[model samples]
Target chain A: MKASDGQLIGYEKEGSELWLWDDLPELHMEAGYRIDRLLHYERSPYQEISVAETAAFGRMLVLDGVPQVTEKDGYIYNEMITHLAMVTHPHPRHVAMIGGGDCGPAREAAKYTEVERIDVVEIDARVSEVCRLWLNRDPSERADSLTHLHHADGAKWIRKPPVPIDVLLIDRSDPYGPSAALYTKAFYKSVYDSLSADGITVFQSGSPFFDMKGLRITTQRLRSLFPVVRTYWTAIPSFPGGMWSFTLASKGTDPLLGCMDRLPTDTRYVNKAIIPAAFELPNFIQSALD
Target chain B: MKASDGQLIGYEKEGSELWLWDDLPELHMEAGYRIDRLLHYERSPYQEISVAETAAFGRMLVLDGVPQVTEKDGYIYNEMITHLAMVTHPHPRHVAMIGGGDCGPAREAAKYTEVERIDVVEIDARVSEVCRLWLNRDPSERADSLTHLHHADGAKWIRKPPVPIDVLLIDRSDPYGPSAALYTKAFYKSVYDSLSADGITVFQSGSPFFDMKGLRITTQRLRSLFPVVRTYWTAIPSFPGGMWSFTLASKGTDPLLGCMDRLPTDTRYVNKAIIPAAFELPNFIQSALD
Candidate 1:
């Protein structure tokens, strides 16, 4: 159930049914919206479903009323992940996104003026199928030319060899049950090893309130690996706990350390005035980081 | 129902029987192992009997699930209002709060250290009664001695004569139903008249997301009356809307123009490190402000 905005609102599902709700509007989208997209259902970790195509513009996945990912607001999160890193880096031509099966981040990666190639490593092929069938009506025509989708375990791919990646975006979920290994230090260091000298990597942590200890530990571990590591927070109306946090790690210059007056004029949520503002963590987060 | 940590999770009243839920575990109190207190009922806002007590002290106004005021967290908003002006001012001693009946803002006034005398003009006697009975069990035990709690309609009190209020805190509710007159320009001009040279006054506008038009009108009116007026926003978790906005106006010396360094200790939310962070309005607010 969502408490805040439609942008980052939470939704949950059971078996073939998918449901989403917000505070102002009691019930938003529901099972009727899910148009024959159920590929697989598993109750081992938690009641989660792998869906194919939905009547809604986006691919739907729900676990206990929490919307895992959707194609509509995917651009907001994807753009935030890819653009923030790409723009900060001096020249990030080669980029890698981990666990973003939907390829939304890859699509956003192609938008960067400086980026040449984008690689997406996702484990779930069903997610890619949903994206291709529903999310991207004309996938081949609309997607960025520089995009390359890979079906593989993101952590395993990063663990081994790779021609030095420039920007790596870890868009994985919580580090519990299914997504546990993804949050380990070994995977993060592998990610650090895969990046170029002046490379930057941005990873979606979890809600600062609910996932306090997780956020703190992951940020601390990433800080140990990278020269400059910082946590940035934002409020997405759809996300659980109403607030979300991200960890940015870089081997090159600390992007946040120095002020850069020049910024690309095409921004919706971010601007020159709020560059530093985004990095300003709450008291609870500050205490956790300390 | 309330969330954990002794926050006023939610409130519901059926007839004279009011239901209060504390999201957290049982709180410790001198009276006994305490639960949530029934602040008021729908039948009468003034008629409230404290059914419980707790060690965690603060003002609690439970109206249809929303806790309007609490003592512990009240300082955050009050400090934000009082300090945002006081620090920007060359000398701000004489202060007044328009509708802070709970005396929480008045209590925060005592913490300013700089201010010589503070007056709290409240329209309702029941608000003070509730605060004293349910929230602040011992009101006369504060360290500061210069606060004057006046029981009078703030709007009527401001119209009679200019009291030269250096820092005025307008802690009224939404402008639609009960608090309609408080949002008018006439009251704002009276507030302007009451302020000394370069004096500052901060007032709660409304939810930027839901009430953007209202926020714009209030801010525009404040700007017309004052030479320097800027809108500052802060996120209150328990508010009706997820994000809340405040308007900070001054006769001179734009509050946003200066750097905030000095601050009173014992602050859980605001500090020197995240001072600029408070002014970072959300995208919806920025759009409305623009």
Candidate 2:
């Protein structure tokens, strides 16, 4: 079936075997995954959410026809996104997440004993509830005490954060439809104001291979508001373009000079050796940013 | 349609539009590319070869229904496979490439004035012919003088090299079928014997995310054969799993201590900063290797 955006978005069912077809019409590419079973499906107030048991990736969380995270490889994305900012800050007592409804980032941030509080502002509450029941099944993995779940618009929540945050992680969806406001200058200004003097804001920029223009614009906008801006990348197999980028904008601290020794040793992806190495962008990416 | 292996391997035609589907049944994933036109198709003595004009990736080369190289992002794979070994050796005068029929690696190696000779031994001559005619069309981009294309079996040719090579690059397909012999200890022994005293050999060692066991075995075999063995990775979007790993085995020279000042300045993906950075494996990959 064709989606409202004229892209193919449906499962090609063959008896009990199912294949989820994710078509990226803009990039003229498509990825298909074999589904073992459908766990849950719902149309939240904000978007469509679904959960499925995949043959290779175990359980997967799909948001509006896009695969967001999977059980097997979720550690790579969650650890990369959360730990990069967590270790970069000298003392990140309070952390605020913009739109990580899956609680993957919250779980990772909670691993750091230095973190005292984690405020997650997600517009869709169903996403959090569903993912918790399906993806995050381990009781020991839950960050219950330090995490405060707020079902409010991230843009509005950031305008007046309850406390100054040392690390602001923008974990929203793509910059489109309802999420477009989060990519604007006004939203970025609010993020800047909600942070401490030595705060750092890290967000997932689009794919370096497919979304060079979007990455360039995001970096430029962040550079306009922050003193130090850097871009790094990691590979997420579930993403359309396996290569994904993240941008870091800091007010005063240099990310490269971060305390690498403070990095959590239990992470699956990030390590003390890779913290500085991640910042070394390839020639094409650096040339694009320049 | 399904291939003989029961894997889906055909282009889904929608009116005039076609999407070439490359299915990795083992990984339970499929990737599709929109084809502008089919340029060529043939059955070689070794495998099936086809060329297509793709909407997102320009010209694409597919071997046995597997996407090998695309003109747009081919530079990343070619440069990474060529330069990492080229710059590591102090003075590499002669290089031997095992199975790069597309001539991408040869073109990259030819950029250096120091590289006097290149010997490319490919089992199938038709692959070289088709790629040269369709994928590599530029006359100036051709490495005509330095590269010697030998239409012969690479595993056999490496056993008795014409001369002592300073760098040996194994650019073959996955370790299967006709190429399976290239991954054995006998083949690696020949490669070690064919190089100079301080020679370095680099080969693509499968995807880290999809083929961890293969990577671990390959690293183990290389470590047994060479004094220094290291595995590094770069992102290739067209490849399944996106993240690709390459293993380097050197006789005496350490890859990390190589002369970074000698890296070619005109390459698109590799640069001085990324040369060392690429070697820093994430914790998961490191743990797997350990």
Among these predictions, the greatest TM-score belongs to 2
lDDT of model 1 at residue B105?
69
lDDT of 1 by residue, A1-290 (tens): 12122222233353555433322221111122333344433332333434433444245554433456655345446556665676677777888888766777776666556777778886666666655655564343324577777777788888763568888999987565446678887888888888888888998987675557878888888988888888887655334423567888988867675333434454455565566676777566787798
Error of 1 at A282 (Å): 4.3
The interface RMSD values of the models, given in order, are 12.1, 0.9
Q: Which candidate is the best by DockQ?
A: 2
The superposed Cα distance between candidate 2 and the true structure at residue A227, in angstroms, equals 0.6
Q: Return the lDDT, model 1, position A151.
A: 76
> Stretches of candidate 1 above 4 Å error?
A1-64, A68-80, A100-104, A126-143, A257-262, A282-284, B1-60, B70-76, B132-144, B280-284
TM-score of 2: 0.95
Each prediction's whole-model lDDT (CA): 0.62, 0.85
In model 2, state the lDDT of residue B212: 94
- Superposition error at B198 for model 2 (Å): 1.6
User: Number of clashes in every candidate structure?
Assistant: 20, 0
